[model samples]
Structure formats: structure tokens, C-alpha cells
Target: ILAALSFFATGSTQTNLGDNFVLGLSQAMTSRSIKEVTDSMTEHLASRHIRFPNTANEINRIKEGFFLKHRIRGVVGCIDCTHVPILAPAEADEDHPPIVYYNRKGYYSLNVQLVNLLVNMKILAANSQSPSSVHDSAIWAASIIRTNVERTFRKGNNIWLMGALLHICRNAQPGTPEARYTLRHSQTRNVIEKCNGLLKMRFRCLSKQLLYHPIRVGKIIYAAVVLHNLAIDFNLNDLNDEEPLIIDNDENVPNIHNNHDVLNEGSRVRANFIRRYF
Candidate 1:
């Protein structure tokens, strides 16, 4: 069942899975059954695996590793948001309009965020079900992982999470401290970008609009992340033989809300990091 779930979650089509089913047990699995098993496996793997470093010592190790490998100081993790295309709800009411799923890219999707503490590009934590229309920063503000990040900092830990330029910077002039910081930040943070790219590449299902309901679609996305982590842990690096399929629309630009502190904190952190390191 785990093998079958992996096969399907790793971008195999239902028809192919059914055709290649392994005899007796294979006879029992319909498209629906495949989804159920995959979702269950996702729940199991996510609960059992996907560990994020919690202690200050653990976080400090990650920070030191980033500084040593990438010369980016104070960064313990790289964070980024990706969109998972999904079909609009079949039945929409005033409370659940189709527009709820229509993102700025003019397509329906779920704005999923992932954080990577490991350099192998495995996700340590994810927020996978945010509405596509919501800004990336807004999703971060509401996420449990963000709460952890804040707590880690408030403890005088001084750990930072590296994010893309747009999310962290606004309009600093060229040669400015903010500009220099953004350059180094984006370079080190490319791990999340590659992680997201390879995720969509390995699970081609993410490169297209899923036919399932949004809720089930989110489950499938989570399953893919879990499987990706397992592949890394088990040393299955051969999965990237083919070139990754590029999703046409990139991540949404943050629609800055009235939450002024989010932006302020981003600027403050970048400035401090630059003055201290760069």
C-alpha cells in the first residue's frame, strides 16, 4: 500500500496505477482508494517525519552550517511560497465563491509555504492550504511555523530565516546595504526555490491544475512533500533524471496589508544582518 501510494503521489496517473496494480490487492483499489491510502500515508509520514529543530542549540547548529557553507550568517532556514494549482470548488455559494481560489496569476491555486532547514532541500515545515488569493506574508503571519520562528528569536536566539528579495525588501537603491543583503539573501535562499522546483518536477501533478477538490488537493500536496523528504533521507537522488517542468506562474507578490510590523521587522532584520555581517 505504501509503495502504491508513493507511485501515485510521485506523479503516476490513476489509470497507470490501476493497470500496473500488483494482483489481488490491486483489484481492491479504485481511484478513490488510491487517494485515501495516499492521504493516510501523508498523515503518517508527516507526523512521524518532517522534524524542525526546536532547541536553541539545534537552531544554532543550522545557523552555523549556513554561515559556513553559504557565508550567510544568522540564517537557520530558508523560506518560500509556491502555488499549487487546483480546480475551483464544484459548488460555490456566496460564502464560498469561485473567486476565493482565483489568484493574481489569473488561475485557481493554493498558496503553499515551505521552510527548509536542511541543505539537501528537504522541507522541515509547511503551510499548505492557504487560499491562493492570500499574500505570502499573510500566510507566514498566520502559520504555526512562523510562531515558532518568532519564539526562537524572542528567546535571544538571534536565528533568522532567509526569504526571497521581494518578501524581505521593498525599494532599496543599488549598492545600498539593503540591496547587498537582498543579493546574498536570495543566493542562500535559492535552496527553497530549488526545493520547490524539484518538488513540482518530481510530482508533475503539482505542475498542473489538480482535478480533485481543494481539500483533497491540499492532502495530495502534503503527500508529495512527505515523499520528497523520504527520498532524500533514503538517498534516492536518482529521481531527478528528467528536467523539471516549470509552472507558468511564479509565486504571488505579497500584497502588503495593514500589518505594518511584518514589513518593519523584515527591514530591521535585514539591516542589522547587513551592518553586522555584510
Candidate 2:
């Protein structure tokens, strides 16, 4: 069963898996079994592995890890979105038109939001419910993790996740605080990039166009994320011979609303952060 799962995850089709010497079953049977096993494993494993810190101790441990490793304080995790390619849906309803899945990259995909601990490379949350047409910022705004963090802040917890910094001044003097902050911020955020790359590299199916329905593809993604955490827990060797292909939607610029109050607050926070840390 494990071998079959690995084969299935590595992009082998049901027909191919069924034709294998080990399986030797019909394609229909293989497909049915795969779905059953995937759903079962995801349900059991996701509950155990794929989740954010809920308690004060757990949250502080993650923040300490970030501060120790990256010199970034109060960072519990890093958040980013990655595109998972899927076959175009054959039918569409009014709520979900066909074009909704067609991303700016000219392919059908699901925009999956992943938040992870950078020090240990453990996925804290995997949200695969958004269509590719959804902007990353919109997804971030609606994310449960974001809401939880906000609620925690209101309670004086003051923990947060690192996200993309828009419009860093690249031409700042090399030794200036702005340049120093940019350098450190980019270095710290690179963990998310490596995390996404490692995920696709390990689960080859994610790199390929998933041939399942969008919903099923989402399940596969979740299952893969669970397996990824397991692999990390077991200290499995990484597959780094080849770089994973990460398809990002360059056109999906985050929509920043024209709210002067919010803008001023953000600028104030950033300046203070730079002055204190950089």
C-alpha cells in the first residue's frame, strides 16, 4: 500500500499503477482504492500534523526558534501561496465559472496558502480551498490563521507571521538601515520559497498537472502536505538534485487599498521595526 501510494504520488496514473507488477489490478479498482486511502490518511494525519500552534507555549516556541535562527523576533511562522496545476473543469456553475480556475499564468490551478515554521520546516497550515483567480492578499485576508493571529493580538499576545514586503527601496545605501532590513527580511522570507520548492520536489505529482477534479486535487494537496510533515519528522533525505518548478502568478499583485490611516500605521510600524532591529 505504501509503495502504491508513493507511485501514485510520483505522478503515475491509475492505469500505470494498475499495470505495475506489484498491483496488477484494473485501473478502476486502483483509482477507487487510491481515493479511499488518500481520504483516510488525510483525515487521520492532518489532525495530528498539519495545524498551527494553539497554546501560548507552542506559539512562543515557534517565535523563539525564528528569533534564534533568523534574528527576527515575534515571528511565529511564514506565509505564502503557491499554484497547483489542475486540469480545467469540464463544467462550471454560476458561482464558479470556468474562467475562475484559469489563472493569469494561462493555466488552470488552485492557489494554495501554506504557513510554516522556518526553523523546522514544518507546515503549520495548508489551505487549498481558493481558486487560482483569487488574489493572494484576498486569501490572506480571509485566512483563519490571520483571524486567529488578530484575535490573539487583541488579547495582548502580540505574535505575528512574516509576509511579503511590497516596494522595498532597492537603491538604498548599502550600509543604511533600509538596506539592512531588506537584506535580513529577504533572507528570512526565503524559507517559504525553499519550503514550497521542497514540497513539489518531494511529491512529484504536485509538479505535474494533476488529472483529478479540482476538489480531489485539493485533497491530494492536503494529503501531500501531511506526508511532507511526516517526512520531515523522520529526517528523510531531501531530493535536491533538481530544482522544483514553482509557477507563480506575476500578474497577481496584491491589491493595497487607498486607506491613508492604514498606510500611515504600516509606515510607522515599519520605521520602528527598522530602527529597533536593523
Candidate 3:
């Protein structure tokens, strides 16, 4: 720490504290054993007095509280995916499935999907810790809070729950109030995309091809999230003055016949298998 800081103080860029700190944070957080770093991070967070939701109950409350008051169109939250690059041990394929094609490393990953609802442009709920292979839509369907949203929509007839994702996104069953709502409100709900960009940009380690052991990679990913949540808690990196861009989207996308469509269409027998499986 002293070495890096001294170099920075001397205005030396080749081997400065800023570079060392970035390397240290990445190596310690993302590429080291999480069990070791989480303890230190926990202690650090304790000193800072920063708190993040550690359970599903707290997450649910945040969601309910946000939507209960906001009267925004077809939007409850913004949904998107981010990849945490992980190590690819040659032996991993023996236990794991085939290759994950979409990752930066094209080796392995813990695909984290973050869903956040912003109230007054502040993050309300931030969901994380999903497997790399999980689908964006499936995460929404499996969300504990979303089931309640569906039930509420069903009772109030406030909007129809003809299908799941559309209702959550506020896209209606074609020409419905919810459909118009989804298109109109999607502009306000795009904060997650921006958040992803800022996070990747701020932490260049995440933007790079991760070269670390798998176990260490998991810890690094969690540590980054914990640090991010802490920043949000303290308003450290919060950007409220910047006016967010809003787009006008009127086009509606169609949902499948049922929840099984992603798997069924890829193969002839697989399609039949999905019909029976669902």
C-alpha cells in the first residue's frame, strides 16, 4: 500500500499506488479464496457501517415498498444479465455441462442477473448470485417477489397477468393497459443497463479476461457486489445530477406458448419432450 501510494505521490504512473490498489483489489477479491477475503471485507464493512440485504425477506420488502408508491408505466424493475468471468480448470467439464459460449473467456462463468427497481432514481432492490447458465426470463419467473406481483395483478384487475414476463415488464396482452405501460415505462427502468456499464468500466478487472482459479473467482464476484452495495448505501458513487436518457419504445415482443419454449424449439425430439415435461 505504501509503495503504491508513494509512487502516486511522486506522479509515477508506471508503478503507482492506483495501479497496485486496482491489482490488489482484483487479486484479493476476485481471484483469491472468498472464505479468506469475505471475513476481511465483512470487518471492513462493519467499520464503515454499511449494510446490504443478506436474505430474501429483506429483498422482498424493498421491492414491495418501491412499487407500492411509484406510479410509473409498465415498469416495476429493470432486468438484465452480467457475466463474472471465472476460471476454467481442464477437469471441470467432467462434472459440469458443455461449454458456455457467451462468456468473455468462453471458459466458465457465474452468470449474475441483477434486477433493480429505482425510486427517485435510487436503487431499491438489487438481486444477485445466480449461476452463469441461468436465463434472464427464468430468474424473473423464479423471483419470490414476482409471484406476489402476479397475485396482486390478478386480484386488482389493475392489469391482466395473461403471461409472466410481459406483466412484470408491464407489456400487456397486446393493446392492453399493461402492454402500453411496458413500452412507455421501459425508459425509466433502464437504470440496470447503465449500472452494468458503470460497474464494468469502474472495475476494469471485471472488464478483462479473468485469469484466476474458479473458487477465487466466486469470492471476487461477491466482494465486488458487496463493495458496490456499500457504495450505494453511502451515496459514494451515486450520480443523481446526471439526467438519464429516456427512449420512446412502442414495439411489443411476443411471449411463448408456455414456459417451456426455450428448450422445446431447438430440437425435433426436444420439442416433443418439452411438451411432455412441462
TM-score of each: 0.84, 0.89, 0.52
lDDT of 2 by residue, 158-237 (tens): 68677663335467798999998788777866667888877887787887898888888899889889888988999987
> Model 3: per-residue lDDT, tens digit, 1-278?
33322221232333233356544544333223334555565446443432333335654555565556544323345545566555454555564443542443344665655444454233323344444556556666676656655665556423211122333322247765445455544543454455665555434445554454454444444455555556666668543357343221212222444646643542343233223322
Report, for every candidate in turn, its global Cα lDDT versus the true structure: 0.72, 0.79, 0.44
State in Å the error of residue 32, model 1.
Answer: 3.2
Ordered by TM-score, highest first, the candidates read 2, 1, 3
Question: Highest TM-score among the candidates is held by which one?
Answer: 2
Between candidates 1 and 3, the one scoring higher on TM-score is 1
lDDT, candidate 2, residue 225? Answer: 90
Instruction: Report RMSD (Å) for each prediction in the order shown.
Output: 3.2, 2.7, 9.7
Q: Which of candidates 2 and 3 is the stronger one according to TM-score?
A: 2
Name the TM-score of candidate 3: 0.52
Two-way lDDT contest, 2 vs 3, winner: 2
Over the stretch 1-278, how does candidate 1's per-residue lDDT look in tens digits?
A: 55455454455555565566462334346565767766776767787667778987778888888788887777877877888888887564555467878987788888888888646777888777777887877788788877887888888878777775335455768988768766776666555677788778777778777766777777878877887788888988656466554433375567665558766875676667778877
Query: What number of backbone clashes does candidate 2 have, counting pairs of residues 3 or more apart or in separate chains?
Result: 0
Q: Which candidate is the best by lDDT?
A: 2
